[model samples]
Target: MPKKTDRHRPEPTSHTEPDLAKAKAVSIACGRRRFLIGLGALASAPLWPALRSAEAKAPAAAHWPGYADAMVIDALGGPGEYAAEPYAALSDKALADVRASGLSAVNVTVSGVGSYAKNPDETIRNIAYWNAQIAAHPDRLMLVRTAEQLALAKASGRLGLIYGFQDATPIGEDLDQVERFDQFGVRVFQLTYNRRNLVGDGCLEPGNAGLSRFGYALVEKLNEQRLLIDLAHGGERTTREAIARSNGPVAISHTGCAALAALPRNKTDTELRELAAKGGVAGIYLMPFLRIKGQPTADDLIAHIEHAINVCGEDHVGIGSDGTLSPIDFNDEFRRKHAADVADRRARGISAPGEEPDVYTFLPDLNSADRLDTLAGLLARRGHSDARIAKILGGNFARLFATAWSPA
Candidate 1:
C-alpha cells in the first residue's frame, strides 16, 4: 500500500565476511573482564550480607534470556554498508557470542532502507539466504516465525532466527509483495523510515498527515495476513492512524517514550497507552537520543521503560535496542553519517518536515550492543518484578509473535 521508490539497495553478502577469531577473542576477553569485575565488586563491598541477599532474591534469568539476543545488526563489524556483511558468514561465531550472552533468539533484518529488491526473484534470494543460514546452523540456530518456533528453538537449545524488514521499501509499491514476504517468514514490517513514502509520513516529517489510503489498505492486508505492523519511525499521526486502522495488534518494535526524553522519534504517553489498549506492544529502544541527551545513563533508559509500563502496563512493553553491530566511539562519525543522509534527502526535496540537520548527535553512554545485560540489571535495581522484567526483556515481543505468526 505504501508507495515505493528507488533507493540504493545494499548488495547481498556485502557485509558477511567471517570474523570468527576476532569475535571469539572478544567474547573470551569480555567474559574474563566480567568475572574479575564481579570478584572485585564482591570483595570491595563492606555490606556483603545485603548484597548477597539481593543477589539471592534477584531473578537469575530475568536480565538475560537463556538464548542470545533475538535481534542483530551488521554495524558491529564497522559502519560501511550493511550488505557488506552477510549474516550467514558469521553464523557459527556469532551464535557462539550470542549463546554466551545468554540469549535464545535474534531477529535479523534481511532488507533495509536503500537495499530493496526490484522483483520477486531477488526477494526470494533474500529469503533463501536467511533460510540457508537457518539450515546451516540447525544445531545452534532455528528459523522462527511464530512463538511456537521460538519455544521449539529454545527447547532444542538453539537460538531462534526471525526474519524482519527494516523498511517497507522492499515491497516496492506492491501490496502483493507483502504476501510474498509473509510466505518468506517476514513477521515484522516497518511502515516508514526517516522520509515520507507512499505509505505514510515518517517521524522526521514535519507535516504529519497520519496514514494515507494506501497505508490503511496495507494495514488491513497485514492484519488479514497476521503480519505484525511496526511503527518505529512513522510520524505521530501516522502511528495513531495505523493503530486505529489495524484489525489486529500492531507494534512500535524499537522506540522510546517522548515523555521521558521529548525526542521527536520517541512515542508519546497517549500513543503508548492506545497501543497497549489494542493489545499491541511498544518496544522501548535503548538508543542515546531516545533518552536524556548528553548524560543518558542506564537509569535514564530504565526510567523510560518504567514510564512506558506506567502508561501501557507491563505486558505491552519490551526491549528493542536499535544498536548497530559496530562499536564506534559514541561520537560524531556516526552522527555525521546519519545527518548527511537525512540532509541529502532534504536538499533533494525528498526530506520529511521535522527532519533535523544533526539527527544522530545525541549519543548515549551505553552505545554498544553488549550493554543490554547491564540495562537489565538496572531495571532489576529499580524494583521491576521478575514477571514484569521477563515481559520487558522479550516476553512482550514473544506474545506479539504468537499473535502475528501463521503456520503453513
Candidate 2:
C-alpha cells in the first residue's frame, strides 16, 4: 500500500514517483509535445480549492440514507449475470441481485470488449444485441440516455444501464457517429482499450504514442455531442493529454493508483490531479493492478480510493468497479472461458501489462449484490464523512452526468 501523501502538493506514488513515473510521463509528454494541441486551458489553470469544508478525515456516520438512497453509480460494469448460460434472460437470482444492489446507474458495455477500430460492424452488432436485451427485460432494466433517466430508473428500482464502450474502435473513421451513437443511447466512450488504434495507444503500448489527429478530432466531436469521455486503458500520455485537452469533464472510468502498485494500467498523481482540478472523476477499480502480490482485498481497494481522494479531493473521486455486480464463479467451465479470453487478448497483443494467468479479475470478499453496501460500510468504518461517501458512491458522477448531458 502507498503511504498517505500530505494534503497539499501531493506527489505521484513511490513506484512512479519523481524518479521514475514522473520521468516517464514527462518523457512521453515531451516526445509528443508537438502533437499536444488545444490544451491552453489546462496550462493556464490553477489548482482548484477543496470541494467541501471538513477535516482531512472524519468519523463514520450511522445516518445519511444508508446504501439504499446513495445513488450508487457504477462507473464501469458488465451484464450482472452469474449463471452458466451466456446472455440468457436474467435469472431470478440475477434480477434479485441487481434490484438488491441499489445501483442508480451502471455504465455497461454495449460495444463489447477489446479493440474494434478495424471493423465497427461488430460495434453496431453490439448495440443491436443490447437493444434486444433491454427490450427483453423491460421490467428489470432500462436504457439511460440522459441523467434524468438515471434518476428515474433508480426511483423505479430498475437497474439503469448507461451504454458505453471500453475502446474508441467503434467510432473508427466515422466521426459523425458520435452523435449517432449518443442518439442510440450510448453516452460514454474511451480513447483506446489496451492497444494502439486510430484514436491513441493503449496503456500497454510500449511507444506510448498518445492520441493522434483522428483521436483529437473524435474528442472534439464528442464534446459537441456532450458525451462522457473515459480514459481508462489508455497510455499515460494519452490519459494526461485527453484530460488536459477535453473541453468538458471526463472520467478515468476504471483504474488503480500507480503509486500503490507500479503498473502501466494504473495512473500517476499528475494524471489524477489534473483530472480532478478540471472537475473530472477517477474510479479505483477492483483488480490485480491494485497491489503487487496476492489477490486484491478490501484494504487495497480502500487504500486506492483514499489515495485518489487525497490527490483529487472528495468531489472528484468515485467508484468504477470494472466487474459485474454479481460474483464470478471461477468454476471449471468459467475458468476455461477466462483462460481463453486472456489468451485471446494476448494473442491480439491487447492484454494490459498487469494481467497474469493465475490472477482473478475481481475482489472475492466484496463481490456481491451488496458490494456497494459493503464498500460504503467499509468507508464509513474508515471514518469517511457521510457527505464524502455519498459523493464517492454516486453524487459526484450524477453531477458529471448532468454536466455532460446538459441541454437534455
Candidate 3:
C-alpha cells in the first residue's frame, strides 16, 4: 500500500508562476501598453483560430456529456484525514486507478475540521499547496467552479477539482471568510462537520434545532455567491430547513436513503423527494453505516441508488463514495479509540417510526475501495439505459453544477 509523505507537497517554481508580476512591472513602465495591446489584438483577430483549434483538439472521449461524478474523495492519495499519501505523490498507477473507475470529475474537499490553520501564514501555505497540485496536472486536472467549467474540463480530458469544505468551523465565526473562499473558487460548502459550529448543529448534536439565524444568513450569502450548499453531516431539521430556505438546489454530497438502510446519516424517502423536487441531487454513499448489516454487496449499493431514483427521479440521483484513503480497518483499534467521537447522532435518539435496524458490518464482496468499476458494470447488467446510467453515474451531478455555479 502507498504511504503518506510530505515530500510530495506542491510548490510553485519561477517557471510556472503566472505573468502577474511581469504585467505589473510593464504597467508601471507604460499604462497604455496593455490597453493598446488589447485593442491591437481585437483589430487583428489572428489569435481567434488558434484558441478555437485548441478547444477543438480536446479529446473526444473527454466530451461525453453524461459523464460526471457527484462526489469522490481522494482516499488512496490526497490531503485528508483518511489518506496515507499526498495527492502530488500519486504515481501514474494511482492516477490510472481513478481514470479506470470511470470518473470524469471529483469534488476534492481539501478543507476539513482538522485542516484549519491558526495562523495566516499557514493558511496561505495550505492554499498554495492546493494551487500547486492543481497546476501540476493541468492537462489531467482543472479547477472548476461552475457547470460550464466542468464541461470544459471533461472536453479537455482533465479531472475537475471542485474545491469543497467539510466543515464551516474553518470559516470561524466570520462570514467574511466564507466570502473570501467563494472568491477563491470554492464551489461547495458544508455548514458543519460531525460537531456543532457557530453556523449550525451537526448530525451528532443531541438537539436538532435546524438552522440558526446566522446559519440562515449564511445560506443566503452562499446562494448569492452561487456556491453549492451541502448538507452531508447536518442534522435532519437543519438539512430540511436548508433545502426549504435556499433559492437554489442543495446537495447531500455523500449519503444513503433511509429507505434502504436505516441510519441517521441516511435520508428518508420524504427528504429525498423534497431534495429532488427542488432540482437537487442526492449522492448514494458507500460508507459502512449507509449499507445494510453484514458485508454489503455491490448490489446492496445499487439497491439504494435504485430506491433513491424511484423517489427522487433520474436527474436527482448520483454517486458519492465517501471513500477514505485510510488503511486502518474500520474495525481496528484506532476506530475503537475514536468510537465515542464517531457515534452517529441519529442513532442516539429513539429510532424514527420506520427506521431500519442498524448495520454494524459491511458486505463481503464490496469490502474494498476499488469496487466502483464493478458497481458500474452491475448497473449496466441491471438494464439501465446508457443515458440513464450515465446520469446515475455522473450526469445528474453535472446538471446540479449547471444550476448552482455562476460566474456572473
Candidate 4:
C-alpha cells in the first residue's frame, strides 16, 4: 500500500500518477483530475488516535438499547438511493435514511467483477466516484481506515465508509496497483467474483481451481499493506488455500452457510471452521442465497446466523448484508430494471444460482434503515445475550479490521 505521506507533498509516481498533470487540463473534459483530487483529499485525512466509546459500557435498554452504542457495520453493502446508473450521487432522502440506519461503518464495494472484471481504469474511476460522494457529504460520511475511526464515527454519529473491491481485477497484472488503491483509502479486496479471475477460481467455476500463483502473490501484497483480504465469492478450494496462506485474518465479507442453503455462494461448514480457527471472520449476508426457494424472512436470516455462530463461534461471525441501506421500491420501474440487470449478469455468466428476477435481495421483514436495530431486537428476544448480539452486529468485523490494518 502507499506509504503514509505528508498532505503537502506531491503524490507518489504510478501509472496514473504521471498523467495527473495532463489530467488537469482536461479536468472539465473528463473529470479525471477531480477524481484524483477527491481521492487524495480523502486518503490524506488524519488517522484517529485509538480509543473506545463509553456508550458500549452504558446500561442496556429494555428494547434494543445496545444498538445506539454498538458499532454496527455492514461488511459488504451499499448506500442506496436506487439510482439508475452506478455510483450516482445519492438523493437527499436516501442520505437521511442512511443516517437512520444507525450503522457505524460500512465496507462498500466500489468496483464490480462481472462485466467490469478486467477493467482497471473503471475501478480507478469507481474509487474516485465514492471519494467524491464522501466529499460531497462530509458531515454525514467519513472515509474509514482504522478501528479508531469506527469508534469515532459512532461517538459522533457520522457514517464511516470503507472502500473495498469485490474482485482483484482492479489491481491488474502488477502488484504495485494494490498500493495505488490503498492510497485511495481502499482497505478490503476479494480475490474473485462469482467466476474465474487472474487470481483464482470463483465459486461458480466448474473446475474449482484453487488460487493461482498470482493470487498467492496478491495475498502477500495485501498482507504487506495491512489490507483485509476477502474470499466471499471464491471457490471452496480457493477459499481454503487463501485463508491458509494469508499472513493475517481475512474475511468472507458476505456469504451464507451452505449447510443451511447449499448454494455456491454459501460457504461450507469446513470453510467456516477453518476461517474461525485462523481468527478470520465469516459474514452471513442478507441475500437470496440464504434459502433454497422463495423469499428468505428474518427467521431464515436468524437461522443462518445461528448456524454460523455454532460452526464458527460468535466472535468469528458477523453480518455483511449484500443489500443496500435504503429500502428497495418494488415499483414497476424497479422490477423492470431489476429483471434487465439479472438478465445481463446471466448473459455475462456472472449471476449466481439464487439470483432470480422475482427473488428480492433485501429481507422484506427487515427492509428498513433500522433493520440492524430490528435484528438486534429479534436476536435479543431469541435469548441471544446483548454481548453476543453486539459482536454479531459489528464488533467482530471491527476487531478484524483493527487486527488486519494495524501499524498503518
Index of the highest-TM-score prediction: 4
* Ranking of predictions according to lDDT: 4, 2, 1, 3
Each prediction's RMSD to truth: 12.7, 13.5, 20.1, 18.2
Q: Given candidate 3, what's the lDDT at residue 357?
A: 26
Q: What lDDT tens digits, residue by residue, belong to model 4 across residues 128-187?
A: 888898889988998898878878888888889999998888777899988888998899
Instruction: Write candidate 2's Cα lDDT for 156-190 as tens digits.
Output: 88888898988877776789878778888889998
> Which whole-number lDDT from 0 to 100 does residue 204 have in model 4?
95
- Model 3 per-residue lDDT at 337: 38
Number of backbone collisions per candidate: 32, 1, 10, 0
Higher-lDDT candidate of 1 and 4: 4
Query: Candidate 2 — number of clashing residue pairs?
Result: 1
- Tens-digit per-residue lDDT, 170-225, candidate 1: 78779998988887788788888756778888887779987888888888888878
By the lDDT metric, which is better: model 2 or model 3? 2
Tens-place lDDT digits, model 3, residues 1-408? 001121111232344233565435433333222222233223212443442343344321111223344332221122223323444454465455545444456776656452335523443455566688677766666778777777777676666777777777667668888778877777788877655677777776779888899999999888988889988777878888999999989888887777666656677777788888889988876555444343333445666777777778778888776653222243344334344323532353312222222232222233233444445544544445556677777778887887888643
Off by over 4 Å in 3: 1-88, 114-126, 324-371
